[model samples]
Target: MSALFPALLTASNKQALRFDGRALTYAELAATAGSLAERIEGAGRVAVWATPTLETAVGVVAALLAGVPAVPLNPRTGERELAHILKDSTPTAILAAPTDQLPPALAELTRIEVVVAGAADPTPERTLPQTDPESPALIVYTSGTTGPPKGAVLPRRAIATTLDALADVWGWTADDVLVHALPLFHVHGLILGILGPLRRGGTVRHLGKFSVDGVTRELSSGATMLFGVPTMYHRIAESLDTDRELTKALAGARLLVSGSAALPVHDHRRITAATGRAVIERYGMTETLMNTSVRVDGDPRPGTVGVPLPGVELRLADDSDGIGEIQVRGPNLFSGYLNRPDATAAAFTEDGWFRTGDMASLDADGYVRIVGRKATDLIKSGGYKIGAGEIENALLDHPGVREAAVTGEPDADLGERVVAWVVPTDRQSPPSEEELANHVAAQLAPHKRPRTVHYLDTLPRNDMGKIMKRALKSA
Candidate 1:
């Protein structure tokens, strides 16, 4: 019932957003976004060219101010995927930056170019227009593995509830400044990275693109938090040993969070070993903005994505040995897939819980350790439900192993035998199958160890750094 961001109407003119080199204060952002909202205030759904720039943020905020649902289109979206999204959402207008070279699919729609010029102005409403909390705020499309991408319609209440809940859990406040270089099309980067700071009345400094030097520069200056995927954090781990400034910068940060994919325990340990600060981990998807996170004051467990947020109710479905598909019910959950009532109905249970499709287990203390995806990462071998994530983590701990992913292959006796795809630390001398097998066996159970080993220079990964295990079945 409260305003999403009260600061837009009441806060002092302090810096709100800084992307690359450009900065905009709170008053400047309100004036710029407010002026734009007046033009398209009554439009149907609008599509935003979600590049990691100031324009994307402004367009989204303007859509919020205008009480319109904004669909964020990935700038690097392929022709097929772009076509699919455009066809599905049917946005009335496409919002982009002046310099954007848009694809042909968006050419037909009414284009709104977001331009924020000059410093903070003394023009802002004492009271902003009210929008229904149940109204759709954004329609974020999922990366369709089964078929064309399905749009997840997120409500205004979902965003507000999730951010406010995160604030309670993370001790977030107005003084905290966030620094990240995540993309704007996805929930983790856009909703949580950009919107979270704004909702908290804090500042966000985006790196445009992630760089070791850029991260260090921002954190060293005044930033208090860092949000990154495993790939970026892996690079940070690889560099922390020699890069004194990077290590120092990380150690000074109040919080470091990783999400969008499982951050291997090796990377987690490496970063902590270097900086004396544990990187907090959270779990979410396109359908759910955020469900759980490691509390800032709680123990920063290496492999765990901490307890459920304030109002989120989480329970495992069809559990055998603690691991099961995670189903959740919360205000933070999306309303449904846009224009797909059948698909939407299928995503939730008859009891109204959203099926997360990810397999995980809760620890004694309620910490969630996400094993992997149910379809690809849950390996059934030798009558054991072995999570591929644990085996992969064990394989990564090997001295000769640079990267690893585990899978289950069809077998006559075991139903499905465990297979390990490993990237060697050195290409010239890959670890033997037997040696690596024994290494995993020692770390985990014998049935959990890899029955066969395949060597590769790299693992196939998506934009979020999550290993595409489905691709490996063909190999």
Candidate 2:
């Protein structure tokens, strides 16, 4: 496969990006990237800190085009986090937003070249260097639940394979316009949300940050595709009944995709009922952009994440009752983690398959169902092992509940008791605790029912829309 920038440039001469209010065609985008590439020649690593705008996009591709490894930093992160990454990666240059405020340490990196992008500059023409498939092209930081965030090294071949698989499975084309609201610092938004669309000559409209009102406006502006996580979809679903414009705007979208975490089956049904569009939930992670998806043409089962994409293999470890630790081996899998040889070695089995920490089962029709996380998220109570996600899905089906998260709480006799944090659609009209408890008992086994339900106005969430269960536990 060709280099990403070159492949994107060759796709078409038509408009490639729509940001804020302006349109930049493929020719124009390539010219900007090439111009930036000339000024940053010889830089071994380039770090970029900017919002998800067209200029930031160009800076990233330009660094790669110039044969430099691109490191994307979250603008909202603290200076300490920034310094640690810089120290570890030792980037030779930095490309940042033209903001007045910057870390003092950033100023002290005298040996590093810094370029303030999004400023006025003259465009220059330059040729991009040839890139090897094995060469590292992007480094994404993943904040582990317990340790400091580690940079996951993704090679050119891995990214290309992911995009190719997405295009083939979804039938992406230039006619599609993807409305992306997720943060670009993460893999889901960067690879599946941005790269996939651009590689197919499809247009992407970047919403700088997520806002229910702002997203409603973009959807009204005629975006054909929408990608988001479960939390974002829940908020949109809540706003659908009162926001006529949002309802009409979302109705125009041809596809609505959700991932990054398990999407509650209740949210899926509610979003479809409110907007007249079915939500397609797929399974993927930071290590892999996408692996399986609910088919667009077939029955989109609410609980199942659907079949694996072509060229991808899925097998359960230990093969106990068709449910086990999920393992995947494919072209799209990451080469390895950066600087953590031991962790990288442990991530794969002897046969080269990557061991996904998720526990899941495969149905007879080839659909994949995520049972729960292999670690803390799965609870054991009264000698019966239970998947918190299963009970969470049942609680979400309750009409009075807006959101729910199930976790294990300490118990004297049961070993662990199932507890839930719930957010109601109307705080003033909250359901009785007995009502919700009974609701779960009707839908689930006695062992799966939540012993305690705590109601909150909102749930703690990370930038990627994952509920921070640790925070909930502390609360």
Each prediction's TM-score versus the true structure: 0.98, 0.92
The sequence of per-residue lDDT tens digits that candidate 1 reaches over residues 264-379 is 99999999999999999989887888999999999989989999999999999999988999999999999999999999999999999999999999998899999988988898
Highest TM-score against the true fold, candidate: 1
Candidate 2, overall lDDT? 0.77
Model 2: weakest 10-residue lDDT segment is 112-121
Q: Candidate 1: lDDT over CA atoms?
A: 0.90
The lDDT of each candidate is 0.90, 0.77
Clashing pairs in 2: none
Model 2 residue runs over 4 Å out of place are 6-13, 110-125, 318-322
TM-score of 2: 0.92
lDDT of 2 at 114: 34
